[model samples]
Target chain A: MSSLEELAQRVAEGDLEAFGGIYESLLDPLYRYFYWNLSSREEAEDLTEEAFLRCLLHIGRFDARKASFRSWAFRIAHNLLVDHIRRGKGLRKEELDANREADEPPLGETVEEEAEKRALRQALEELPSSQRQVLVMKYFSGMSNAEVARALGKSEGAVNALRHRALRKLGTILESRGWR
Target chain B: MSGRKSKEIKAALAEDLLRRVESPKAPQRLQVYGLQRILARAAYETRTVERRWFRNPALWRRAVVLPLTALLLLAAGTSGVYAASMDAPPGSALYGCKIFFERARVALTVSRSSDARLEMEFCERRLRELQGLPESGEYRAWERWSREYRRNLEGVDSLLDALPAEESAGLAARFQAQLEEHHALMEGLLKITPAPYLPYLQQASRECMERLQRLRHRHGMEEEERGQPRGPREEEGTTPVGDTGSEVQDGAEESGPCFPSPSYPQAELEDLAPYGEDTAPSGMAWTSDAEDNWGSSPKESNGVMGEGSGHEGKGSANHYWK
Candidate 1:
């Protein structure tokens, strides 16, 4: 919400009430971003908290003109994700399987549709982490190229090129699996 | 790939798939509650720090040190007993006065977690001081220092026990690691300690190590984390001597006469600012200049204490000091 920008200003002034408003707006998208990447609900939640805390502490450093509060917030979450991966704290395979089952389509899907969706999910998962992140932000989270670029610290042009390449690869994987 | 048919189909499919992938909403109660807790904690820490500063005796002393020195000397008939005891070594009469002063300090500290960590830091300094002591003669000094070491070790164990198991895990692991480092150094010192005083040093180290081993076991931490050996006796020649002094190197050198190193590093502090500026929105630029501790009132038994409480409150203080 546009109120997030105003909330950021208040948060910079040490208003925890304003921080609560910002948290409500961003928690879901940020949690979803991490969940899509890490495939672990608990870890995503933990990382979400860590990112928000860092944001609350360093809110003064944020310049709204440089990036939207959403993008700035995502940058914090992205850095945390990088650190988590660097530390080799990824989930085990069994945990991944359990999470995947829960993540399956909940209702009214034909078996064929669910299978196709699973195949597409696998294809996306097979992409490199950076590309996967771009796709998740662009597709699932619905962030625009400029926004994803800001969040990922890449140029807008770079994000567009990455998106094009990622979409081609996904198409290739779908065709290969005969899921198209 | 850019053909009209392919483009249309790809766009439609991408839209459908992305839309269909369900993104679960964050759990409202847990998510909101967690943020509330963090916000409440940050606000609470900011308030305590401000209160501590207003009520801080050391701050008051600095405001009129020269005038107070003259007035105290005129009134007390003897040099200020508490101020003079600041430099007392472990066994001296002044040292008891020093502990009494610390009782007030520990009482005023807002965070129980911080107090536990401070006690651990003291145990480390006492161990390093014990190692630095002469091997021959001065048995009285050695005994006194060893007694203080045991007392501080007890403080660490008891304070750690008082904290919730989850909250104390990181500090406890770090304390265990540093204790093992000293345990290694004590092994080296055992051969050289005066034969008469050797048993006292041995007993002090044994009790300290046994307590540390139990702490580690209780937390399910591995001894090999700091390269300490498992079970009671550490293998000779295995423990690294570097770590013993390494943990003691926070800006202790600059603290000079009065201030000792802080109990923990900025990173070890859970509820407070990292080091420099308060988390308060006072409109000051945030700088990473954590070269010194927060400059809180120095720990009571300074000067004669070990190297100093380095900025790395936990073993990670290894970063700034090393």
Candidate 2:
């Protein structure tokens, strides 16, 4: 069994210590996925924390045959993202991301590299929500097509199509912006 | 050339997107606080369920077996039943579950603005639940829900006060508008909601209206200082900007964050308190119930008061919390 599955089994069987293991594993991916989707890191963290709260509360209902704990947790995050957008945080949040950038530049990155990343964030924000979710899961969260599909409740083929479409549209946005 | 550009952009996009969320300390911080709270909550939930499970065989079927079947069914279908929680009212067996999710949300949300938003949502939800209570049969429920309603507004008040003047402006604008609507809604609810709820209803409506009035007064003062045009109300030349404050502002509470904000100073609230009454006027009064509703009494609520901790015994908004 996968580590997440093992952890879920442990948690389900009442070893609360496993909560830390599973939480550490999922935190980075889930936090990154949410941080990119929302404008403020604080808001992202709140939603991320909320998603885990739900996961812990509902761990018993989890079925490994249906989805991995990672994807199931991602599904919870996805629903929250949808609810957030529905509450009018969607398009309006993009307006805020126009100003905020990465917390710290990684080692040896250039000034222009930072600007390009900023432009790319703006571009990513413009992509449709489904496409963005697929990309964030596949690339940022390092989930497989099947895992992304399971998280979003879409077929793997549909997930692939979204990734393709997201990439095509992202390229168009970057080309038009010409941020060299 | 276009194809090459597309490839480079896509590659850069993927790489840069992955690099953006790199906060190292935040997760550890979250882990420290999140685990303890989640476990404490888990323990509390287990106890509540166990306590009830042993106490009532009838509730056992209702709480355990039925929910187990529902959880199985929901494992595939709508996951919302558990997440948003069943709309279990105050005394329902699943009500503890409902409150557990709310506490987790509030406990997990450390950001001031996020907390304000969540409190706004909760206060609004509490009001809606109260409205739908159908009759005066549930006085305890009414008291519990209304107390939460008051606590939420106080939470919002404290959060907004804590925000820097610049940061609070936009959010306060939105909140002032919302509180206005809530004030109106509560006024309407007071008239229609049944009799047994009169004192609580009267207190709620008055509190709602007074809070709206104070925020509006502060908001107006800020606009004036910024040298912007007066609000539509003042522009209409009808409401004497501080008419309410001038007549009825509470004297002892001026030191509270509620009144002396942005443009107005604490002395100004004192100046406005023409009457000798030490108590706040209407919605401005923070009662013994000012402490929030997360199973914490007013005294215990001060534990997380953070910056507002100084105002503890001084009858700042914390005075209203019980």
Candidate 3:
């Protein structure tokens, strides 16, 4: 079986240190997945912590035969996002713009390149929620199309269509902004 | 608008930009929030088979609820005795409560002036109680009250000494004026005072006089003694000079065994024995409000002969000296 599946089995048996291995493996994907979906970094981090807490609390119930641990974790993060949205806190573009200011340019990236990335972020915020979920899970969460579809409770064709449509919309947006 | 830019946007969306955005992992920032705590709790919880006694309501009632209930009950139970003790006289059961509460008041009072003022009130209270004692068969009660009264005086003395000259002046004048009135009341009591009790009353009166003069000298106030005789013997025409009243001048003031004075009315005698206890109703109490009210308007008190403090309680007491 996979290393994550082995860790999940040990976690079920109360091998405490083995749970750390699973946490380290899944922590980044869950954080980036939430960050791209939410307006603020703090919200992303809180939800990320919440996802892990739920995971550890119910680790004994995980069935590796049915799904990979990463897929299960992504499912939890997605349900939280859905619940967060249902609670009347969807992405607010104004806050998204405010939080985007903290993304300082990396070394060797030109000012023009940074501006292009900034424009891309704004355009990404304008996409529909379902398409953005598929896009964020596919690219940022390291999930295969099948895993992404399973986490979102959609078919593989639906996940693919949502991804392609999101990318095409992003491309059209960049073109409209006179992006090079 | 341009064909080349459109192609670049397409490529960036497909591969170039998504790769860069996917790798934006803030591992350090994530550590600051809560991932480490999750890891630690995961380890700690699974490592120990926690019995989770905190979840038991029975344990919570035993650990928290009972102690709080007991504390609240104790406070409510003692409040009655605490209230009654406020005016308890020297030999009464609640008298100790009076002294204890007075000391606690001084300790709790934050301002030095207010603290000194409180002690001054105690001094006055004790002096009035001492003066109210009967001349006959109350030597033990008299001595007990006299000692406590002197101690209260000493407390006020040190506190006054520590006060600024400006503040001490007004306070000493008021204190002297209050004592002057008490001296006058003592004179009224002296008209009926018997012979054997003369020396103790004389000596006590002399000590009070000395303290008053020291206060006047210290504060630069004019002597306002108003010609009140020092004690029963010294008051003119009340008792004969060469009679038993002469015992004070003959040095019996120091070591005399005082007897009860004659002609004391029974009502006044009971009132004197245990302060204003004779007039106070059984459920009536002295309160901090009396001290506070007297402090705010010391001039309003009708002096030692005035009604004893009327207070807010189930019953009211009106002290009488006539």
B-chain TM-score for every candidate: 0.43, 0.48, 0.51
Per residue, candidate 2 scores C-alpha lDDT tens digits across B1-322 of 9887767676566545545533323455576787677677777766676667656688788878898988888775545545545577754556567666776788898788888788888877877776776343544555566566777788888888998898788778887777766655655554445433433555555455556666766877898999999867556543321222222233322233233122223332233221112222222332223223324433443323334433222334233333
Residue-level lDDT for B222 in candidate 3: 35
| Model 3 chain A: worst 10 consecutive residues (lDDT sum) | A98-107
Clashing pairs in 3: B132-B272, B135-B260, B135-B261, B136-B260, B136-B261
Expressed as tens digits, the lDDT of each residue in B1-322 for candidate 1 is 5675675566456546667766666766547597886676666655665557445666666666767787877768434777887667655678677667666667788987888877777777676567557432343555567667777788778888888867777888888788777777776665555333443565566566556556645643444665655654233212222334322222322221111112234232222221221111111111123223345322321111124432212221222222
- Where is model 1 chain B poorest over a 10-residue stretch in terms of lDDT? B277-286
lDDT of 3 by residue, B152-206 (tens): 7677778777888677777877776765655555555555443223233444554
Q: Candidates ranked by lDDT, best first?
A: 2, 1, 3
Q: For model 2, what TM-score does chain A reach?
A: 0.90
Give the winner by TM-score.
Answer: 1
Q: lDDT tens digits, residues A104-126, model 3? A: 55567777667656675677777
Q: How much lDDT does candidate 1 score?
A: 0.64
Q: What is the lDDT of residue A24 in candidate 2?
A: 80
**Chain A TM-score for each candidate, in the given order?**
0.86, 0.90, 0.89
lDDT by residue (A34-148, candidate 1, tens digit) is: 8778866778878877888788877889998889988999999999999998888654456677877876454677787667656766777777788889988877666889889
Worst 10 residues of 2 chain B by lDDT: B273-282
Rate residue B208 of model 3 by lDDT.
Answer: 55
CAPRI grade, predicted model 3: incorrect
